[model samples]
Target chain A: MSLIVFAGAAQFVGAGMFGMGVGGWEIVLTTFVLNFRHFLMTSSLSRRLPDNTTKSQSALAAFGVTDETFAVASMSRDEKLAPSYLYGLNFTAYTAWAAGTVAGVMAGSILGDTLKQSLTFGLYALFIGLLVPEMKRAKPAVTAALCSMAVSGALYFQPFFKMGSGWMIVSATVVGSFIAAVLHGDENE
Target chain B: MSKLNIIILMALVTYIPRMLPMVFLKNMRLAPWLNRFLRFIPYASLGALIFPGALFSVNPPAAAAGGIIVSAVMGLMGRSLIAVFASGVAAVYILLLII
Candidate 1:
């Protein structure tokens, strides 16, 4: 999953660089845009974990707190968010992500550059296929999505902000999510 | 600009935001209002990624028109997500192939 994120970043950066070359601003923007979700994930998970959990455990477990890991942890019915279990979930996910990335990068090293380029779209399609189901049944989820799109679109054209697209994306997501959560936090309760 | 430098810069910048909340948020509880905001993150993020690329495809207006139509019909008719997305994907590719 991280690798997919990386590939997406690579494409955006590579394409941007290809067209405009590297600007410090573009790099700054793309990085921010692509990474905002992790912060959201962390914020949510930190709230979900048991209050008694140790700081070290919380921090370590956070290493694994991703969308996939969050889904797993949140789904577990246990009321107390055990640091051990959270860390365990993080362990497995990080391991899986790292191992998969290594295997892919190593294997990709053997593939032609064009083939690798083509694989980029497959990642987006895979992401879409995976993400679409999550949005379909949940109205709040759909609302949240629309909010993000609106924010991103608005940001794209705004001249005053002068921020890179990446950071802009993050800002849009964070703010969009905040709006979604405010209106829809009721369902969880 | 070297690819390595650009990638490393992205790595550091991206890493800070992604990892910061976990390290710092351990002490911070979700405020009543903020909880509502978090629920929408995944949905919105996915929307942010998908809508642009799909709508801005080779034949933006046409493919988007088709995707929008198919998505609406499938969604309204209570078809499965797979069915809904399949219709949209088919619409996109078919439109692309034609144009």
Candidate 2:
């Protein structure tokens, strides 16, 4: 699944749903919604690629457009990102991801249940690590993040809101970012 | 459907969104409003991914909160990703041990 899907979040969500006996369509739909962010990442990245990059090379490079890779590539100081550079960046990340998965599987059996449960916190921590730097750069990102948390929290805990986790994230992100964009636009004007 | 079929479907769905934009929208310019919205997506998604769900991810939930605080502080300090992530995990583990 890791080799083929190559998406960490979607793989996690898919595995959880499968464990709980979710149907195929529901799983697919959830995965699609969760992965929709990649569209924005790839769109932004495409314009940065060198003009001489071939369609086939772009297609191959697109396969490796994970969040971590996109962040690294975007941060590069180069005026035009070479396809080779992207390939190397993506390949290294892909190797690390696959190797990490293997390592986790091997270590899972040796770990105690309590320790295993505690490790779940790492996922949230990773998110915070990804978010805080962005918040520092753009104050509006702080607003967006807070709004998302509020919306997501309400959707998850409120009895009136029956949406599943995938839809909840999608809804929260759209509303939160939309609000931030409006506020940001007003400030610019 | 079979597990194989499901896996194939997952791969398709995951790959299509990532591939289409790079392949087809390479030179297309985005509107300012849309660009603004896209800029906020990483933060918004990370925020949604962390909250409420993170609280319920571990026992007592305070452990998760502790990890979040540690990660946020370290991240703000311009710490490396591995350092922030490892410190957060270690904080959670230590908190759980104390609890």
Considering every candidate listed, which one attains the maximal TM-score? Answer: 2
Q: Name every residue pair that clashes in candidate 2.
A: none
lDDT string for model 1 (A143-187, tens) is 777888788878776777676555655666777677777777567
lDDT of 1 at A130: 48
Winning model by DockQ:
2
Q: What does TM-score give for chain A of every model?
A: 0.61, 0.74
Model 2 Cα lDDT, one tens digit per residue, B13-90: 989889987887666678877777766666776788788888878888888888888999999998977888899989
Worst 10 residues of 2 chain A by lDDT: A70-79
Scored by lDDT, the top model is: 2
Lowest lDDT 10-residue stretch of candidate 2 chain B: B37-46
lDDT of 1 by residue, B1-99 (tens): 565666666666555665566566666656767656654565666556555544554344565656656665665666655666666666656665566
* DockQ, model 2, C-alpha based: 0.65
Model 2, A1-189: lDDT tens digits are: 888998988898899999999999999988888788777668767877887888889999999988678766754557578889999999999999989889989999999877888777776777777778878877788988999999999898898747767678778878888889888885651
Error of 2 at A140 (Å): 2.3
Q: Can you tell me the DockQ of model 1? A: 0.34
